[model samples]
Target: MSATARVLVDGLGVDTVCALDRGLSYGDGLFETIRFVAGLAPLWSRHMERLQHSCVRLQLPMPDAALLLHEARSVVGGMDQAVVRMTLTRGVGERGYALPTTAHPTRIVAAFAAPAMMGDAYIHGIRLRWCETRLAIQPSLAGMKHLNRLEQVLARAEWSDPSVADGLMRDTDGNVIAATMANLFAVVDGVLVTPSVERSGVAGVARAEVLASRAAVHVGDISREDLLRADEVFLSSSVRGILPVQAVDDTVYVPGPVTRALQRHWRGLGFPMEQA
Candidate 1:
């Protein structure tokens, strides 16, 4: 997993970095996992928007966008196909939860090879297990992909079933939110419904696309029973695109009309299925 990376910090904007940044220390930062297409990010605007939203919510200063872009290009310049991870921190705040009044935020942009291809999800669906760890409902940081992801990490670690491609998680109130790492959607009576991310779950880019394309997308509190009784289920992420879930618990479902239509739309958008 060794790879080249670049760092910019503390207004000086030098590349060689120290390990003492607060982003690493207290997870007191925000980040975005961006997909660079043809040496460009098609969804760069969305990523930036989300990053800005996260920074405001976290009370962290927004770093210089032009510098961040320049650093990102440098990081991605040396890689063939890459997923760039940009991290912004509170910039070495004094040792406490108190915010530094005027410290510059530390920024790091690291690029690495895109995930190994897992083949066509449209033809062959993936399996998912229910995660035991329920999400804590935090409306304040609900939809942004913030740094505190220990809940997902723990949920993923609960099972070593490599057969299970991912795990679906619910919140403490039994509201089905999303998978351990991705957003979920279900087709109920020809309608595409995703859990309302107003309480939890990262509002994924692909999920936004589908909701926009298919105007009737319902975002509301969904229960596990609602998931089980649905006609079809699928997951979406920036990297994974559209992944149909064949089985959840003992009940199973094929990729139904709604999911298939969404996949078609997603392909037209840019990220085609591996088989397509």
Candidate 2:
């Protein structure tokens, strides 16, 4: 826990939500999991863009960036490294499904210490499992980090083995989508290939950074066979950065040259991913 781990509603320092809040009644909200170092979010613009896109899709008013930044800075004040999560809800509403005539969006921002999983995972690699739960094809909800995440919740609950660092999930059509917690990427014949999030899955900020970097990137459908036969594989997230995948099921893959090059690239960008 961070000494500054606290939640604020709207712009006030508060800790509770109303019973009829739309976010509680229905999963009507968007959230951004941001990594802040020295009281600044390096990828703040990208996270804000994604949050604004989700608000537009949900017919909710977008928040002002200056206010959000101020609140986030307060929450992460004096922290060397922290994870600051901001959630915006549609506010309280009636019992019916109709949108309230007067919608007051609720904002909650909280901070926590960054989890300590980057040491060994970054140095060596992580083992993965194939999850049985599949994500439904909902184009309207695709690529948005909305509050409704039961699909990921169920997929993450499939395994209890501590050795399995993460699980890979597919869509209803059996196309590989992403890992339960991070975006999936594979290097096929020296080209960086990542599953398109058009039909499902969240578009991770770190994944977007890697795609926009000087790496050869391709976005399309990746089958199970394609993933297993790829030369290198890794996962991307805001908190964890890039994590190499050591094995999936019975197959084995050592952290290859491509993964190493990307790690170097990410470190050069000021996201020191290795143990100090």
Candidate 3:
């Protein structure tokens, strides 16, 4: 852990996790990366909703929300701006795939200094590339921020260019899924659209917020051609807010009005969206 980060394990300040933890051994866990402003998590309910849903799906016990929030606030302390990541795993388990008869879930809450605002990217738009790594279609595990992230790790490792902000990933069927770390939205035929997470991809908190907004947003399959020909494109995440897509490979885009509108909406939510 970085010296600037504060950690709490199972409600106690700690830096080490049991080596036999299922999260480390089998990747049996779920996590949420939340942005805190003024010592509060603005989207706390949404993050908890997702975490609860994932707990039910994974059969892992859900920690009490009040306790989780307490731990989150404890780690964040009085920081005006921070990033709090909550990791829940099916505690230490026997050396096998069999589920423990009675499980003791591990809760790790860590708070780090918020990353510097991507002012230039937010203002001029960000550059992206098509990643070779494709997401597998698995409805059973879809839409949850689970710990199995080998695909994203591999896709991210494919690039080292500091100029590239992120990479867009496609599913095995060649449908545009999302950026490695964010959900994608595009304006096609002047209609707002985001690819469905029912088959693959994460249902990010920011994406949910955008969908709940007044905009008529469509959730369906998006192809590379559709994205290329779209009127505008942007990416959304809880921590990063909204990022306009300036280009994908050689295809260039002039950040359009729709992207700006969403950015304003994000700003309205108390997250910062400033130009450098």
Candidate 4:
């Protein structure tokens, strides 16, 4: 079958390709969706680190970062709000699981308009449901945001209510991991606690900053009961930054002291904050 993709490759430049590349074939690839402001990415280094980590795990070669940055800048076209997506595949290969020595890696960089900052996500906070899809125990791939996201997709599909903003996931042993796309944090007993990404969940770039910068905060296994008793809860993501959790199950929170302060620090970190 003929390919329809128009993304660029490291050595081949821009070319027409099929969608049924090995990436689509066996989820044999990795990708990053980065939000750019005024065609600039403050967190490009973080994204590059994660992307390189993923490439190493998948045995996919890292593309020339200098060249990739040029492509990313070119695609935005001076848009104030932009979302640059970078995808790397092991290129086309034979119909098998073994890595092909002859196959070259495919590179793609595209830009789009950014999504609205859930103003309410910062102030009024968000609602969450418990997901039934449990993340698998794979430490080698645990913290990397690989393309194999069927677990998250299935968990997200469990809810259709627009009111349910996101879903909290767990590992196979029922230990809390993170939200479908974002990381989760809770303040129990005035201590900020989040799930340790051991068996599942992508360790978000934003998550690392929060843990390192916040006081008396660290990673741990937080249960539903722990959240119910916590003073506040919030979500974090590379694009979304920090968001308060107003309601979880039948419980409600006033967004707590730590969560609010973190929101302020997060804004100083360069992400947009809720309008006061």
Q: Native-vs-model 1 lDDT?
A: 0.79
- Candidate 2 accuracy as TM-score: 0.95
The numbered model that scores best in TM-score is: 3
| Error of model 2, residue 93, in angstroms | 1.2
Clashes of each: 0, 0, 0, 2
lDDT scores in order: 0.79, 0.88, 0.92, 0.80
* Model 1 CA RMSD to the hidden true structure, in angstroms: 2.6
Candidate 1: stretches off by over 4 Å: 1-19, 78-80
Candidate 4: misplaced stretches above 4 Å? 1-16, 274-276
What's the TM for model 3?
0.97
Candidate 2 per-residue lDDT, tens place, 92-144, comes to 88888899998899899998887777568886889999999999999999999
Q: What C-alpha root-mean-square deviation, in Å, does candidate 4 show against the real structure?
A: 3.2
Q: Which stretches of candidate 2 lie over 4 Å from their true place?
A: 1-4
Ranking by lDDT: 3, 2, 4, 1
Weakest ten-residue segment in model 4 by summed lDDT: 1-10
Residue pair clashes in candidate 4: 3-17, 3-18
RMSD of each: 2.6, 1.8, 1.3, 3.2
The residue-by-residue lDDT of candidate 3 on 1-80, one tens digit each, is 55878999888778889999999999999999999988888889999999999999999999999998998888888888
